[model samples]
Target: MANNPFKYGTIVQEPYFTDRKEELATIKESLNSANHLILISPRRFGKTSLILKAVHATKRPYIFINVQRAVSTADLAELIVKETLKRYPLERIKSFLKHFRIIPTISINPITNGIDVTFNPGVDSNILLEDALGLLEMVSTKKERLIAVFDEFQEILTLEKGIDKKLRAIMQEQSLVNYVFLGSQESMMTSIFEKVKSPFYHFGQLMHLKKIPFEDFHQYVQEGLSAVTTESNDLAKRILNITGCHPDYIQQLAASVWDLLNYKKLDREADAVDTAMTQLIAVHDLDFERLWTGFTKNERRILRDLATLGKLSSKDGYATSTTYSTASRMLKAGYLIKTETYEIEDPFFKNWLLTRLS
Candidate 1:
């Protein structure tokens, strides 16, 4: 089989996962106990993938809803209803919809060869929440726990009006379902989950999804490549050195390298891996550009500083110009990461910015 290890911008499954056993176990334990969870992580750290993997492993009727683009209560409700219906038979879905008082005008078209159901909220629009809750309750009453995973949940706060409060109330009253709130934007997630004044505060256990340990990831890369007869520890280390164990980046680089070495001799030279990493970045230039466009000037400056200084805080305070308040904000925003002695985040972007700025 061809070595196709890359899964950039997609969910990672079990066989493709590198490390994260402990974190996965924690999520499983929480689900087993019927406890809700909030997963917060920096972007591209595999938060979505991990949750998807958990959902697949749970062996339960679960609904994964991406609320990133959901700007209204109706959109969220519709998405949940649609995903729920997708998991069951049409008759069961119609029955469930009836219980929710969501009277979808059902019709069949000869061209489509499927039933079309359109919902109209009518006067009592707030009943949507009630109906959604009722549907979940019914699903739960079926002796199976329903898990609703809200990805990019921070977007809920972006709703025009006070929808967050309504969502909080609905989620609080949901006795039959478990909620998993996943957010890649750390600042938004923490504000929603950690701030006492926020409606979602203390609603669930807070969990952060971090990068897999370097050694374990290296092992996985080697083994995955070995399956296609193009394995090399040096290639794995070089990829890690550039991607810094970022799961998506690692997969992308590995995929590029695998394709490059298809039925050919492995590049054993020290600089060969570096060349491959460069090519990977060049091939995915548009992705990196889009990522860079999301950052503010200060955030970009912080990244450049890290790339140049090779660290955030040093004994001599080399990058000391970045004030404590700014650092804290950046850290909260996931633009910066702080360790006991070192501080850095998004190693790939840092390198890219540094190179561009220089």
Candidate 2:
């Protein structure tokens, strides 16, 4: 009779969100100490949600920008200017940004007074990037500490050569601003932040999001699906195992199972879970197909081995490290995430792979 409590396809907020207590604590500690951090995780692992939660919980004056679609460094400047205006008034923010010798054109709509920002098409993009980071510095001066989050921060790699050097140069000067860079692509993120050759190498502490532990996940589900008549606790464990304890998939699978029981009136828990999984796989068919087709023959072989064997080590079918490297590139790209052992990135994807090869 009630709406499904489990949520996916968007940000999962409080009450509905499962345990991230330790993560929250760590994030808060970083913010309080004015430490810059790289919040790294694979796509859909809830990096955005965690960032939002941590920012809100800290109650700091912050600008959150997602530069995932930014086409150039100039575009990135416009994005930061727009997002900064969203948080602080245009007059106030513009005053701070105006100090920069190379700032974007900031304008307000005549009727709505909504802020819009842009840069000259002919200007050097590096200058635009410098001016953008300068704006953040100006704002940080207004408060004891300002929090700035650039979600999908790894996407900056495509902007221009030495963007990292430029960004690092500007950001390292901010003594009062606490910055959190959230990125979904672990490989690119790591390369940018961890490699010794990187400008951002050791610039900030690293935080990798692990899958929610089974005990915590089990308890969270049990609490949410109250007044359980069936053995939903056992079902929760199965769901976690099936989904590989992935943050988004756990919510997705839980939602599917909940939907079957609530709306479809599925009486059997097993039946509900099975139907849920089938429907989920249906939704992901095209995605999995694209992924499967993208791999080369050798890559396909590696995937088939992974799907068939469930793990990539100590088996007769075990491929050598070099053999796996070609496929393992996907691991760096976050297509395949590492756990206690090597496996496919997505559990449902493994199922789809099995179906395709079977």
Candidate 3:
């Protein structure tokens, strides 16, 4: 059987990556100019994939740091230094360490052939972090500016109290490095970058990534489905209709549909989508159940209404303002997305809720 023509749950490269022509051009321009960037998007919206694709096109030394992996300021610093070493050699970094107030203990790891950096316990982690970042700027030359991207950058607020101010201070002085901050949480990211009182106010060019436009994604899905089935257009529309053009969901549903057609050795069937949706929900039933149990009574009521009734109202002991408030919370939490109307973000979750209501 031909390999599945769809990919999801990971960074998608060319052939699998859908259209982002305008976004790619904008990011490439920003990187080429060495401008710091703040990219905000909802979860699983292909933020990482898009950023990595653009960064690779530059053909310059770059470091990717996911702020979520960082435990503390020191850990954040260590992560940055390690990524830097992977690109540059140790001999060059040692010269820059001599200027640090609290020098980190650096050693080479034999297993991975990579550098390991450690900071002393109880020392000022902020200083260690500053030095680590400075090393990047220091080592970079005018011709080769380094690109550093921090994913889940909103988590930095939880790391150190004044780290934002400290980061802004350090980033402002570096001219030879481009800093890119990416966050999945829109509210927190907005506060960090848009708020005047926040240290990152007007710090970089802000870019908000929305779902791939329907026309662009439709072509991509149809092309992939057409490889195996002749009824590709109808199947593509059905998948997009269910997924609302969600990038990750499109890949997942397409994968299932492909497997059902290829492995089951059946011709294209009308019920293929229904069967695939059922299988997808069955695979994620536990996660959906856990998510359902976490909601308050009113919250669950709201979700059930959206899932089954397709609309919610103020009646049935749920106040009008309360319903609005709950939905706004869900939208912000990534449970629902606002289109012409508020709907469950995950199509499979909506399907799962339908089963419960039935």
Report the number of the highest-lDDT candidate: 3
**Range of the 10 consecutive residues with the lowest summed lDDT in candidate 2:** 310-319
lDDT of 3 by residue, 78-193 (tens): 99988887888778887887998988788888998767888888998878888898889898888988999999999999997999999999999989999999998877898999
Of 1 and 3, the candidate ahead on TM-score is 3
Q: Which ten residues in a row have the lowest lDDT in candidate 3?
A: 262-271
Superposed Cα deviation of residue 55, candidate 2 (Å): 1.1
Q: Which ten residues in a row have the lowest lDDT in candidate 1?
A: 311-320
Model 2 ranges with Cα > 4 A deviation: 109-114, 141-143, 227-229, 286-290, 313-319, 355-358
Q: Candidate 1 at 102: error in angstroms? A: 5.0
Error of 3 at 38 (Å): 0.9
Candidate 3's displacement at residue 156, Å, is 0.6
What tens digits encode model 2's per-residue C-alpha lDDT throughout 226-296? 54336677778878888888878888888878777666467676676677888889998988888878887
Going through the candidates in the order shown, the clash numbers are 0, 0, 0
The digit string of per-residue lDDT tens for model 1 on 10-107 reads 77776787678899899999887757999987787889888888888889888888997566666666667666766666677667776665565656
Question: lDDT (CA) for every model shown?
Answer: 0.72, 0.79, 0.88
